[model samples]
Target: MDRSRTALIWRYAGRGLLLTPLLFLLVFFFYPLGSILQFSLAPDGKLDFAAFQQIFSRPYYRETLWFTTWQAALSTLLTLGLAFPAAHVFAKYQFPGKSLLLALATIPFVLPTVVVATAFIALLGEDSALNGLLMKVFKLEEPPLHLERSLKIILLAHIFYNYAVALRIISSFWSNQSQRIQEAAQMLGASRWMVFYRITLPLLLPAVTAAAALVFMFCFTSFGVVRILGGLKYATLEVEIHYQSLSLFDLPTAGALSVIQLMTTLVMMIVYTNLQRQMTQPLNLQSSRQVARKPRRWAEKGWLALNLIVMSLLIFAPILALIERSFTLGDGGFTTRYYEQLQENPHRSIRAVAPVAAIQNSLEYAFFVTIFSVLLGTLAAYLLSQKTRFSRWLDPVFMLPLAASAVTLGFGFIITLDEPPLNLRSSYWIVPIAHTLVAMPLVVRSVLPSLRAIKPSIGEAAAVLGASRWQRWRRIELPLITRSIAVGATFAFTVSMGEFGASSFVARPNQPTIPIVIFRFLGQPGLANYGQALAMSVILMAVCAAGFVLIERLNRAVIGEF
Candidate 1:
């Protein structure tokens, strides 16, 4: 009878804990999303398909759809091609400065999209040193390579920016894999290539598929890279949404486009999740005692060296260009003018505000996003860990924001809340709200794994020793999951600071964020503007680096290792 009573009490307590996250999702996520869908379906205050029909009827829109689809597909393929070998190398080999190289590879992923776009321009722009050098070497009167405003440039930028996603996912999975299977195949008279194809590739399929799906989705919704490099010719759903809403003031059409984009993203995510379930297997490499061996043949070492050198150049060249350009002067001498410009107010700029204001705005939004997302995500994770029916359904729902494009969601927010008791536009709250939507999913993913790692009996034990529910949570669960929460918060902070798509739509004109400011400067002409842009980019990089270091230190203190 006592055991039954205890079980019943615990069940109710778990249910109560679940309610908070449920309420949060219902209010912030589901309701806003539902409002947009409803508004898109009935833009004229009656049931109609006018918006969608208009979009499908137009040839331009159809062309955009095709362009976005193929470019994203090509980008994913290229990224996979580059990332797979790099991931394999990192997983199988140990070398000097491996950690630094890995961190450098990840830098592109966290950088602001505008910074990346500008870096590409600085590297290959009309008056760039690369263009000048090519002209000089070839004795040509004109710039020989005109990659600007081309589909190929857009695709390359996407691959460069998102390849890290594939590398990280594949490398993590590969590191936790045992070499015994491959060794056994080799001993059975299998060639090295055959062994990899027959054994290693099959086991790595899950991570590969997951990474591809994610990369595809990211490329599909790409806006800044497409807009900056592809020019007006290449319009993805993201770019179309922005142009339709802001430039053309076609809210209904934008809403319709957003819905279509959301559906496409959702389908991809569902396919990936289902595939992941089927691909699951016991990963015992973590406990396996055998150490990895280095390649013995000279040819193998030469091949490995060539691969590493090529990957390093591909990943590092653009970054090196940016850093070098940041210091270069017109007279071919090094200068600190760009770095100094960051400290001065440049009010004559289009935005008419000090650069520091943008930095502060980004930092503030990131802080709020980190705090709220971590708190709410931790609660949701705890509820999910308890294994309730409602919790199971809720788990996927929290991930909807991640599956939806930021541009689409921002458009949804614009149309749905143009007026009403929940009107949010034309307010300071828009940017942070949009950021929260994006960061929440990262928070949940990070927290859920840690929450699941803790055994339930620990909480029960504390409760049995006359501890109150709050005391049990404070002393046990919180301590166990604190590192995960910090990691989630760090991710949220970095994402919020660097995010551009939603910020462009929602940020107030006077209160533009760092990325918005960088874009503004890059669009203008002149050495001063270019210098300022580079300075701002450096500042943004410093902020991200500092935040990551703090996260690393906190993780070590709380969880002992990442």
Candidate 2:
């Protein structure tokens, strides 16, 4: 009877742990989101659907809405088609440096969109090396590769950003699938194409759907890439919102856009969750390592080489091009002039910031974001790893920030946090707090997998061996959780560093981070400004690469689908 009471008491105590993160999220995330809903829908102390009505009735808003949907849909399709074969190779084959290659492919996922835009420009822009080569080869006066500021370029960028998501998610699911079914089909005289068409592809549908929904959501709310690369000809919902609120100071229009984007994202998030859940439904949980082997046939070797070359070109060419452009001068001579200017802050009057100051600010913000997000995520991980009554439903709510537009969150913070006791309009801490909303989900994802892997028998064994509950935790749980925490902290730092969405809204003009600095430079004219943007982009990529290297080096034992 006493033991039962003690267990009951501890269950309630464990449940009480959720309150901390819940309260924090309520204040920072939910309250701000609610504030945006209120501010837009009821601007004059009265509810009205006029803003939404205006959006549908106006040609500009209607076009943006249509473009956002179509672009996202097209991007999703392109990404899936491009990524499917790569995912297949990763699942079925073994290769040297496979893990490193996979990690390299995933680096783009963590990069700021501005950085990616700059990289693409460096690779394919008019004066780019590839264009130089093409011009020389074709003996043409015009640059042959004219991808800049085009819908084609936008789709390619989306493919680059989302390639790993499809590869990882689909491969992870595919690797666990038993090979016997496919082998049976082969033995029954089915052609290779027939086997894959009827058997392999069908089994991968759930994961494919999940990846598509997620990729679509990302492309839908895309702001930085479109703003930087889309020029004046294109506008998505996110771009429209940015222009409305920041450029035009049209709050009602921005608010309506935010609401529309939020609703769309919510629907996709639900779809992704349901589809992903279906991916883990009990099946033959077999390992791929035993089934996977290296290529031997000529056709197999050709296919493997093709995938490798294509993936490498897609992933590394932009980065290499950016690095080269940063050093290349007017006469095509190598110079460090652009990098040298990073310290000068020469274009501050035109919104350009000192690169060093921006780096320091981003690092400082990332530091606090890591601390706050890890703490909140640790609590949430505990709730998820245990048998908490509400954890199942609460799990997806924690992921809302991942799906929500950063611009919307930033705008929400602007209106909500600028008044009353939460007057954080000028507070330096606000950016990191805003960043924490996104970073928290990363930490939760990183930590929860390891937490869930803990066997109950380990604790029972410690108790039976005369260790106190606290002692068992100190000697057992803490060490196990520490690895995940370290990785989670790295994730938090990376998220905060590359975060442009929330930072776009919260970061002050003069006190901008690296992405903001790069953005400001890119938006302006002149060769010097463009060169500086490339230089800063290289720097940002280096920082992100280092962070990803750190993450990969850390305990990859902590595994979960993000």
Candidate 3:
């Protein structure tokens, strides 16, 4: 065929692939969001702001908003402080087990909120084994600890979940900086602290700001963490949304709160995105092989040691406690009954599925979500890298679902699909579709950078040599972008696996996910239930860890080969 016809065919094929994501987003995201707007505006076919008025008039709603803001701010500050030093260490040094340590640091961030809450409770609750051990060590007559059901506990969990965000974003920038600037600063009689404050810290400010904004937004909209650990006293906007929607059935109030929350999040994202754009600069280095020749003084060693210790305690201890509880017996012996009990059907409980079935459900949903999200995300990323106006506009629109809370989105889905024209409420597809909405942004973000890194000339060269479009993409683009696709798929898998908010709203009674099952077990007050929760948590962690490792291996095989 002539070049004109070949180009035409290629363009149409590309459009077809790209249209899939747009269609998916339109049906699941924009349609549901439109439904939410309609619900909030019209009650009985009349336009009203009663929902907004009710939310504003109530002191409880105001309190929830205020508490949520403060808690999220505090958590962001704490996470940044802890993550800065760790990021610096990782960026500057080539330590043993560096990859493994980085992986471990991220584990807590990806685990289900319910699992993290339960793990924390297992380690530090009033009746926990740690409290018992402390009591014995101190020779006290009673266990004296009250960590659970406190605002502090909630804040700590937020920090644990988000520190990786600060670390990764800041450190990625940090690794690209030229060490010679710091060396020159040192040679000019600048102290270590002075160099960091005046040079390193200033350089990292953009990424730091972006990371903080994201973390703050996450904590502000937190539901599962606050619900499980914050008790009734510490309700965020998210928890309030949940209460208004589910417990009180006050859709108007919930809808109003969700709109406000969505507005606030969008504002934050806009401001952060603008700031990030302003601060973007060319990297001094692109490779991670760059080394800092500065010797590790005693203080630096101590700092590393302290960070390692803190990470172990803060991230791994709770997970270890969960595993221990899963195996510990009431009579102080090891047992496997918790795992065994998972084989039993959960229908015996209150409107719950079998634990094994929940696992199956979660895995199946995760698998589909991963596949769909990666495909859409990859296409969007590829289009965006072409730097077309159409892709730029579409890019931010695609990310809107991420800014909205899952609770808000779930409510939107519920209100939108309650009727006949396009009913999706009772379908199994609802949860996976919601999950795809949630996971797509992550996939796009992961793949976009890698796509941009591939020079446009490579594809042009193939076309000039009379190579077919399919052969060019298959032999060139696909090989280059496969690792990114894998990374995006891994992220989607983990996000869907641990997802709860949307799942809770859409999950069928007979098809509960693992997180839902764990939440159920935690609600009941029995050894068997608690053990089962811990055991399920362990399995959830294992699933996430195994997925992560597989992705890492893929990265090594494909991306690392370059």
Candidate 4:
């Protein structure tokens, strides 16, 4: 009777704990989303569809939407074309420095979009070192590369940012795929290309399609890259939303665009999720050790070396260029003047924060964002791990933030939280709150699998032995999932450190984050300003790199999920 009563109590307690994440979603996610809809559909408290009508009727908005679609499609195709062969190499071979190469490939995916854009500009901008070298060598008066602020640059940046998503997904999936079928086909005298086409291609379609969908979603909503590299010519929905809401103060139109983007991404997420579920279904899986081998033939060695060189150039060249350019001057001398300028505030501009101060502010914000995200996201994971009806449907609801654009979330925060009880427009906590919202989805995704993998029998046995619920959780469940929690926390910290789109809206001018500082420096003219921007970007990149390294050390097996 006592055990039964205890079980009942624990069950109720678990249900109550589930409410925490729901309340968080209500106040932060759903409330803000509702406010956006309300503002757009019924500004001045009267029903109106003019915003929607304008978006549909206007050629500019139509062209923006069309451009957004085609660019995303092109990026998806280009990334797949480049990453597919690389994925094959990573999956089917054992090479020296393989682990390090894979890790380096993934770093770009985690970097801030602003940093990615900055890296490209440092490498290919008219005043860049590459251009300068070419001009000097060829005796040309003008820079040969005109890729800056062009569609080509935007597409290139997207490829750089998203290459890892396809590579990791496909490689990880392919590594486990059984070789028996292919081997059997080869025994029957099929050519290598024929085997790949007839057997391997069909099997890999799900992973490739899923990767394509996710890459499309990211490029479709791209803001920082388009805004920085595409200049005034290109505008994705995310950029248009930012322009309308913040620049023009057209809250209604921005909200409409947000709704359109939100619906589109939600559909893409659904497709991706379904495909991922297909990937997780039972299969005749094989270990990488059984499938992968070192190159034995000269031809194989040459192909491997060629792929490695291409991957290295694609992933590392821009970063190296950015680092070198940060320390280089027009006079062909290297100096630390740019780094030194980070500490001084010569202009004393109210809108500008010192780079040193910005760094400090980012660390503090990241700390709190990590705490909030871990607590809330862990709770959400716990809730979703249960077998109850409530948990089943709630799983996708928790993932809604992943589908929602960060820019839209920021705009929603601006309009929704202006009242007395929830007023946080100018509060210090606002930035952290917004960041927490963005980071929590990642935390939930990282921790959920670990929680669900825990056998219920162990917890039942502990309860049967008179172990209290809290004691069982603290002693057994906590230790078992600590690594997963750490992974989530690290991701949250990294994400908070580099977040730009949402930060642009919520971060105060006087207390800007590192990305904001970099953006400001980039917007200003002169070589000194450009150099400072590069310096700040390098600092942010280093922080993100360190965080990723910690995560890599924590669990290499789980990094693929990221």
Candidate 5:
């Protein structure tokens, strides 16, 4: 009778714990989205489709939509093409510093888009060192490089941002898959090309498609790159939303664009999730050491070296340029003026604070966000990992937060959470809440694999030995997945540290984050402002890179789905 009562209590407790994540989403995610819909479709309690009509009827919005789509498609193709060969090399070749290379490749994916823009500016802008050197060398009066504020730079930045995402996903999947099928086909009188086309291509298709969809999703909703690199001429839907809402104060148009962006990203995410599910199909797997080999021939070695050089140039060159430019003025002597100027409010601006304060504000928000995301994400992970009917449908719903753009989510928060009980527009807590919505999905992704890997029989055995549900989780699961939790926590912290889009809308004027400060510095006139922006970006980059390295270390012991 006691055992039966205890079982009933534990079951109810489990169900209650599951409801926490659902409640969180309902209050935060769905409520904000609903507020945007309500505000856009029916202002003053009347139905209207004027915003939607304007988006379709106007040439400007129409062109923006087309540009957004085509650019994303182009970026997707270019990223996949660039990363595929690298993925193949990483998967099949056991090279020195392979793990370090993989970790370095992934750092860009975590970096703020603002930092990426600054990196490119340092490398290719008209007044950049490269163009300056070229002008001096040829005794020319004008700078040479014209890539900045062009379509070419936009594409290049997109590829740089997403290369690691594609490489990691495809290579990780490729490494685990068995190569025996291709070997068998080759031994049965088929040529290498024939075997690759018939057997290898089909096996890799799902992972490739999955990577493409995710890359397209990112490029489609790109904000910082377009806003910074493309300048005033090019505008994606995300940038348009920001313009309409903040610059123009046109909420209807902004809300309409938000809905469109949300719906489009939803489709892409759904496709990605489905493909990812297909990618997990059981296969004849092989260990990486068993399949990977050292490059023995000169041709193979040359190809490997060539790919490595390209990867290094593409990923590391701009960053190195940014760091060098930060310390040196256009006149060529190294100086610490920029770093020193970070503490000065030269203009004594009323609306903005010093860059040093922004750093402190960012660290505080990151601390709170790490706690919120780990708690909420762990609950969501446990709920979704359970082998229950609810888990299947809820899985996609939880990912909806990830699909929604940060700008849209911030806009939603402004409109929805302005009431008496939930008023947060002026509160500092609101920033962390907005950041948590973005970071939680990552935490969930990082922690879910650890939970799913646990066998049910082990839990059953624990229960049979008179262990309560809480006791079993605390004693067995907690210790087992500690490293994964740490990895998730690190991701949440880093993501909050560099978040820009949502912070732009939600952060208080005097309490800015690091990215917000960088944006402010860039907007101001003078070389000092630009130098300060670069200095702050380098600082933020170092923090995020350090976090990424820690995550890699933690994740090595327990690999996560991320």
Candidate 6:
């Protein structure tokens, strides 16, 4: 009876580990989700399908849904098409600056969507110098390239964002395939085509599927790029949700769309999650270094040189344009006028805010999110280490925020947390709270892998040696997981700095995020305003790149998944 009672106490204690994350989910995630879902279904006291009826009845909703899916599908295809070649280049070739190139490819994915849009405009917009030069060269009256405010730009931006994810996933899978099989097949007179189709492709399918699913999910929920680039002509469900809730004040429609977006995202995420599990299954293959060789043949040399030029131009040209435009005056001479104007209240009529304040706000919010995310994520990771059925089920739940659209969460803040006991609309804490929802998932995923790696027998051995639980954690577990936690912190910091969709709904009027401020600057007319937008974008890009590099180095000491 005593032993059973003791076991019960320990069980409850172990279950207590989940309380923090569970409460966070219940209050912040579930409550807000329930509020939106309830608004859609009930609206009043009694249950009704009026929102659904309105949705199905309206051509607007149908069109938005169609465009969202259509664009997302196209984005996924383009990203994959771009990624396979890049991944192949990295996997098969040993070259100088390969790691540097790979890292640069990843930079776009980590950047705030607004920054990317700004860069694209600076490089490809009708008024851009590049376009102007091209027009002069071609003797065209109008700017020949009309890439801005169109689906083409949107597709390109989506590819930029997802390129790294596809490359890493596919390359990792690619590297693990044994070269012996290919060699053996070649010895048997099998063609490279036959070997690839009959062997290599079959092996690569799992990782490809996982990467594609995630890319689709990201493209499907895309907001910043679409909103900034697509403008009034295109509307994804995310943009539509923002429009209905904030613009039109149609809560019912917004609520319904949020639910739909959430459901679709959840399904894709679940699929990716399952496929990822399959990707990690043991593969009997050689390291990439063994298979990789320097460019020898003319074709190989040409391929390498072509990839170098294409990737460099793709990643660096836009950024260079942004920098150039930020400096160039209306008369075309370089000046610090745009950068200098950041200190003053440039536009009084339009919600005037100092550029410095916006930077401070972004940094402070990022710091807050990093601290909170690391703490909550550490606790969640601890719970995941328990290895119970509940823990297994709970693993995916932590990732729900990653799957959920930022706009949906931002809208949830307005509809639920704005009133009564949960009233946080006026509080700046709400911004960090929203950021935490997004960041926490990354934190948990980063740290959980490391936590699960630590054998419980080490803790048991420590316990038998008279080490307390806290001491064991401090000595053994903390040391092992610190790098992962650091990785999560870096991700949290970057996400907070760059987050736009959720911050859009929750950020106070005068108090705006960096992305929000850059967006505002982009909206105003004038070369200086445009230049300032570019300058601010340059600043943000620098910050994210620096933080990513530093934190990435920290994670290299520990074997943890991003």
Clashes of each: 0, 0, 1, 0, 0, 0
Error of 3 at 459 (Å): 3.7
Could you estimate the TM-score for every candidate? 0.90, 0.93, 0.91, 0.95, 0.95, 0.95
Model 6 worst lDDT window (10 residues):
341-350
Record all residue pairs in model 2 with backbone atoms less than 3 Å apart, i.e. clashing. none
Question: So what's the TM-score on candidate 1?
Answer: 0.90
- Candidate 6: regions farther than 4 A off: 1-18, 135-142, 347-349
Instruction: For residues 1-562, write the lDDT of model 5, one tens digit per residue.
Output: 9989988987999789877978988998899899899877986679999999999999999999999999999999999999999998999899999999999999999999999998898889876888888998999999978998899999999999999999998998898889889888888999989987888889999999999999999999999999889989999999999899889989888998999999999999989989999988898888988889999999899989999999999999888988999998646899988889888776643255788888899999999999999999999999999888989889878878899999999888888888978898889999999999999988888889999998889999999998977899899999988999999999999999999989998999989998888877777777888988899999999999999999988988995887
**What stretches of model 4 exceed 4 Å from their correct place?**
1-14, 44-47, 348-352, 557-561
Predictions in order: lDDT: 0.79, 0.86, 0.82, 0.91, 0.90, 0.87
* Deviation from native of the Cα of residue 151 in model 2, angstroms: 1.3
Error of 1 at 536 (Å): 1.1
Best by lDDT: 4
**Candidate 1 wrongly placed segments (more than 4 Å):** 1-18, 132-142, 175-188, 283-291, 343-347, 552-562
What root-mean-square deviation over C-alphas does model 4 reach? 2.1
With a 3 Å backbone cut-off (N, CA, C), the pairs that clash in candidate 3 are 346-354
Residue 448 lDDT (model 3): 82
| TM-score of model 3 vs. true structure | 0.91
Candidate 2's TM-score reads 0.93
Q: Please give the lDDT score at residue 528 for candidate 4.
A: 78
Give the per-residue lDDT of model 2 (tens digit) for 1-562: 9988997887688667656888788998899889888877998879988999999998988988999999999999988887888887888789999888999999999888999999988888887888988888989899988888898888888888888888888888887889889889999999999998998888999999999999999999998889888888898999888888888988888888999999999999999989978987987768889767898898988898898899998899987888998999456889999888877866353455577788889899999999999999999888777676678778887888887899999888888898879999789889989989988988998889888888999999989998876688789988988878888898898888888877888898878988888888888777888888898888888888888888887756556544
Which scores better on TM-score, 3 or 5? 5
lDDT of 6 by residue, 58-107 (tens): 99889889999989989999888878887778888899988878877788
Q: Looking at model 5, report the run of 10 residues with the lowest lDDT sum.
A: 344-353
Please provide, for model 4 over 198-260, each residue's C-alpha lDDT reduced to its tens digit, 9 standing for 90 to 100.
999999999999999999999999999999999898899999999998899999999999999
Root-mean-square deviation per candidate: 3.5, 2.8, 3.0, 2.1, 2.1, 2.5
